[model samples]
Target: MAFQWQVDPEDLFVERYPQMVGTGLPAADVDEVRAAITDMWPDRSGGWVHEWSRLAGRYAAAGSPWRAALAYGWAKFPALADTPKRTALSRQVDQYLLAAPDFDVAFDRIIVDAPYGGGHVAVPVHVLTPPGWSAADPVLLASGGVDSWKMDLHGWFTELALRTGMRVLAFDIPGTGETSMPLSADRGFDVVRALIDHARTLGGGRVAHLGISMGGYFSARSGLAGEVDAAIVLGGPVERSFDPDRTWAYGMRGIVGNALGFDTEPTDTELAQRMSAFTLRQWLDQDRNAPMLVLNGADDVHIPQADTLVFKGRPETEVLLIPGTGHCAVSKFPEALRIMIDWLVASARW
Candidate 1:
């Protein structure tokens, strides 16, 4: 609960910085992080990594494991296949594990068979049993976005665990975090299906999927594939998500490009074709899907409102569009999370 690091409201990096600071750092330590990041503005290397790493060490030395973990994670944000990025990621996991005991959760790192390609991959799943949890209780497979890894969503997982007494399994989607799989346009839902299969073994063959941002795309797809009993897609893109004509910001484009394994940024046309592999509209068959809830911010820049609109009148689907909020309606995350959890509980009961 040390997420107090606040960035300036008017900061140019406001698009990504606020969530970065809000989710990962303590409020009291906000100034130091802000100052360091400011000094390293427009630079992802050199002093930037050093500043965050030093800050992380300071927090670790002070026994604030969560802050340390977040600092390390920030050090690797907008990940690149580099030594420093890899080191920061490893340290982030280490600090997160160091903080897990305090939260009363048993963290386990394991490997599961990827449903595609006949390959095995490592997935770090955080396991938390809420009070009154039973072996027959259902499980929630929680996931995060491109910039925010599974570690970033730990708080959300704990909230779901407490709210429903369901065992929560937090894992990275195929391309992010410690998931040992190559990133591809068609990689996510298969990985999630594999995870759902794994979740069933832990909880009486009952599991639900909830995902944020790009993970929401996978959650929606999982529901369409009947991979899970219930699914919630928060700020996920379905139709326009692949349209080259839909304007995307530099950072958003970077994330999509990077996730698809491009060594360099791809042309908009190439990016469109690459992303086309993920378009769900063409594959959707309403009769074969599970009940789903699609929610997003009316102002979400990365995901167009059209994405949410396309789900309208779809069988067993409900959509919530909040005005004046940004991507995934992250500004209303706590409220949205409550709604998501309640729906999951109700969906499971049905």
Candidate 2:
């Protein structure tokens, strides 16, 4: 069966354009690529991947590796399902590495062993250390959603490092980006635990976690398990999103399926069955939890509001529902980032 998109691809392009620019893509380049995209799925000219790749090549030839990386990032934009998209992801990584040396903050890309399914998987992580950072400072493990992987979040990570004077560790969550493992609720936690363990080795061993979008699910799990010093869940689903009766909006179902490592789109029943294993309800009743901050836009179309509300009565947890915004409070991200950074600084002191 053919994959069906919940939202029209053309409309999605228009809706996501602002977010692309917000995340650091040049406006003029994005406009050119947007104008060239007549087919969203085809692999040839006028297709999403083709046009974006064309722009990426131009940027690369012009000695603008960062811009090339951003363009290639959009080429792989929602998922890495097809060959062209996967190729785009490869180029994205190459361009990002090429641009890394010029980053304002110093960083190191290291590989750590993450235990998974009776063995270990090599996980690539980017650790950025701010000026004057020392062993006495704290560390933060940060990650983005299924679609926006580690490289896509470089700006946010750098900003956090610079503003907080904390070492920022960024990695792709399981089943996304360069992670070798597929998404399985039980196994995914193992990957996160491994990251936490590695994080504890850096700085003062005071570690925090910041998860955005689907990445928030892992952060919530780490918090509930008391694995990190603090955890930030920004627009992540904790419970209701996995309910069989819950519905997805704006093509989230298919997008999630692709991130879940599905070769083809799964039926609603199959999706629900798989997703149910991801809910954190069983852990909610537990007494132990890290200091947690749960945040999301009140009108998030992707995640149910109940997911953020679920933390209301939990001890040592702060929940914020930004009004008049959408998922992750993208429209008001600067405000949200300030709140998150302040919370992290305070959490570290404790």
Candidate 3:
């Protein structure tokens, strides 16, 4: 499938920090790197890719293969043609492995079974345990949205685990990254349950879920199903996103459709139908709900602000609706991360 630009590629690149800032690059370098990517679809003038590729080559030549791999991964961001995407991804892996010995924490990449289509699918996860962490340590599943793949969240996930002292298993939501399974709203939680099952095997202890953007939806679902001990849903949409009356602006619909694995952008009606399958309001009956924390930006354009309020009456649920913040609340990442870490620490004791 030829990749379609969700929005003006320039605007998307300029607005990259809310998503890519913590991808193990210096702040100025992140800005410079994003500014250098001036590509658009229909002809994807690959100036951006070229720059990243050039950086990768330079890093490799300097004997810093991990830095090179990280650069190549940046080049593959969002999406690309299969041939180039695969090549970039392979280079990223090669570089990451080459550079692993230099890192403070070692990472284990593993695949777990998850339900997909009628059988099961493999869900790839990058696991990092704290020093002296035993199998008995609680596991926290960290994930990102449709556009934010797992690799991009590695640094953030690592810090989260280190701070909270929880074992971290970071992965992408179904529609993105290595999950690659067909996306179905109703079946998405099956994957979370499956991951929880796998987490129990690691230590047979508590497992919490923290997800950003689209991944938050899965975290919310897992919380509601009591599949996890705790969940932090950041900028997740529940009813408002799927409401047929509320039209999404800024290519939000297209972003969601891509996550749903649409061959083409689905019509408004079809999008609503598919999204409605993910409604957490229908499952809020005080049944198997675990402690939940719903956080979001008040000015979020992609997700309806009211969606965060859906957890209001639920027991052990907390909502932190920040005013003047944007989606994912990336600008306030430190504050948000602190809140989540505090909550995770508290939840683990319960």
Model 2 agreement with the true structure over 1-350: per-residue lDDT tens digits = 12434446576665577678988887887887778788767889888889999998999999999989988998987777777888999999999999989998897999989889999999999999999999988899999988888898788889999998999999988888888577778798898898889898988998899999999999999998888888999999889888899877666777788777677788888888889899898888897798999999998888989999989988789999999888998888888899898987774434
Q: Which of 1 and 2 is ahead in TM-score?
A: 2
TM-score of 1: 0.89
Most TM-score-accurate candidate: 2
Task: Return the clash pairs for model 3, or none.
Answer: none
Compose the digit string of candidate 1's lDDT tens values, residues 143-207.
88776778877777787888878888888776677774645556556677778989999987788
Q: Which ten residues in a row have the lowest lDDT in candidate 1?
A: 1-10
Over 4 Å off, model 2: 1-7, 347-349
The deviation in Å at residue 100 for candidate 3 is 3.0
Per-residue accuracy of model 3 over 3-122 as CA lDDT, tens digit each: 354566566654565555556655666666666666633324346566677778888999988668777876766553345665677787778778766655667889898877689888
- Quote the RMSD, in angstroms, for model 3: 2.6
